[model samples]
Target: MPPMADIIAPQAAAALLAELVRCPSVTPLAGPAGQGPYGEGRYAALLGDRLAALGASVEFREVEPGRPNLIARFDGPAGSPSVMFEAHSDTVAVDGMTVDPFAAEVRDGRLYGRGACDTKAAMAAMLLAVQSVLAADGGLRATVYVVSTCGEEITGLGAKALVGDGFFAGGRVDAAIVGEPTDLDIIHASKGSGRFHIETRGKAAHSSAPADGVNAIYQMAHIVAAIERDVAAALAAMADPVLGSPTVSVGTIRGGSQVNIVPDACTIDVDTRLIPGQTFQTMAALIHGVLDRSRAARGDLQYVIHNRPAYPAFFIDGDAPLPVLVARACREVLGRSTLRAAPWASNAGIFAEAGVPSVLVGPGSIAQAHTCDEFVEIDQVVQAAKLYAAIIRAYGGAGAPATGARGE
Candidate 1:
């Protein structure tokens, strides 16, 4: 490996981030890949080479056929604590972007492009952290795994599969840090999300003879009303003090083949944000209860609800050793102590479900993510690299591990 000062510098990290932005690695369809843009193989290969150059063992852990999570491992001495740093590789589509999505333009100390803020910056920081450790004695007292996951903008398929595959040789990873757009603050908790569809069915008939057929649209209207009136109240009452209230919104509605016919089916897609105490089953029951009440009011209605996968909410004790180390690093770099909860879902939730203590801390603002003109401060990106490097040094650097090593 080259000297850490050469490979892990802020300019080097920024260059890596710029190259990642140029990849246009948008979410691929979740199946067998065609000659299309679904494969993250290109990005994974690029990262693999860099990890290998730094004397790390790199592997492409395939979640799907073409979407592989890049797992780069730098081994430390046996019995030393290990830490995993996670970042996602996929970005949302660039259908309506104001700037060229793949241009990777840098202006006034901000990098503008897709994935610049939502996460590729964090990827660069984690990579530099690993390189910095290797530059100092070729390894740390504790091992480190830098994983770049795929399909985070979609379903978090890579993270789910990575955790299922048994992280860090199926052994304990003392702590994990997920790089998300948290403005460089430590995120102790984030809300989860659930999506599902509800459908109502009825007989189709000529609109001219309105009384001849029951209206599924009318039934759906009653159902929607019930959900808005009752289920919402239930969610509001079940709020968590830290994360605030759980909430639901009906995003889309579709029905009726044509205006002349009475619709046989009406369907609505719903999105719900959950707090720690709320489970998918619990939320499902609440919706079902409301539906039943609507059904009883109109005996001629038939309805079906299908739930998509759910992301459970997660929280870590703020005073835990991992958070303390991360907070100290942030303070050292930024000269301020900042901590908060995120309203969006992150892989941290997935790791927490697996019994690994995880927190989210990274370079940009969540506000700029997925926007038409997305961008991240170049200074933040560089600072994030330094902060990550410091964290690795504080916990896994030189002769003996720190007092907070292994969350002691």
Candidate 2:
């Protein structure tokens, strides 16, 4: 293979990133043309076309119609382990942005756009890095898969579908790199997330008729307070060294429509971030217990708990081959090694749950993701491409690297 330096050059990475930022691939929201959120189908198609032009086998997998995922494979030597580089194609909706979300404008050294920092930049870097490596002898001991997934902004449905399809069946992947903006930090673990909708029911009655009916809003208030107290305590006590601690937030609440009438129903949407060693089932049971205790105290109220698995927490051991290689690559290409953990959820968890060890490493910062005027440093794009090339060289060989510490 040619030297890694020649494979992922600065100019090539910057050009790829610029091309990606030019695509207006914002997540779709409810509204009119150009006024509403941008669609990702066009961007996926563009990426697929580029991959095909680069001689990689490209497949467009549609999770939902018009919202497609692109998978491109660069075949390597026979009997080599497969490595997947994954990133989301979708960006959060740009509802209240000051700048043109699709301009891909480069000011100073940063590229600004909706998806520039969130993930498209990382996708571009990975693609250019893979293409560069393949351009060289192309006779490596591993196949590289570039996957651009949809619905990462909404429950990671694209990743779930890919995992459910057994895409990694037959022990194909030895390791995976999920390109989430981490400021070039290597994330070995990330918190899992679960969404819960709690509904309380009661009988409506006239406001003046004191004891005529039960007030669901009033009942829900008590329940919400109890949950806040209990959940806060639980999260604070359940702390992990790497992930820090679990977190709970009462994100949304809806109750009475009219002020005079006693409301009969109330709904509370809760978002909980779980650290490693915590499962959705376990968390759900804890929530149920909390509700049960509250209900027991108030026999007049009725409530229901609906639990949804947003994403599971993932942890790769500190000594894991993927993390080690990623750290080494960052040191070689960026003059520093990265070792950190993500506080939020990402698609890396999906790969880990599928038994494919994965790590998160990419350009940009998480702070810039899902925000107005989102941008990524042009230099970070180049550095990420070089790091990708280094990882490919390090892990695309016989005998995979060793596993590291599994963050508790």
Q: Which structure among the candidates has the greatest TM-score?
A: 2
User: Over 4 Å off in model 1, which ranges?
Assistant: 1-8, 29-37, 168-171, 397-408
RMSD (CA, angstroms), candidate 1:
3.1
lDDT of 1: 0.81
> In angstroms, how far off is 170's CA in candidate 2?
1.9
Candidate 2 per-residue lDDT, tens place, 310-357, comes to 999989887777777778778898899868777788998888887888
| Candidate 1 structure quality by residue, lDDT tens digits, 170-196 | 556767889988889998877888887
Residue 175: error of model 2 in Å? 0.8
Task: Report the alpha-carbon TM-score of model 1 versus the true structure.
Answer: 0.92
Assess every candidate by TM-score: 0.92, 0.93
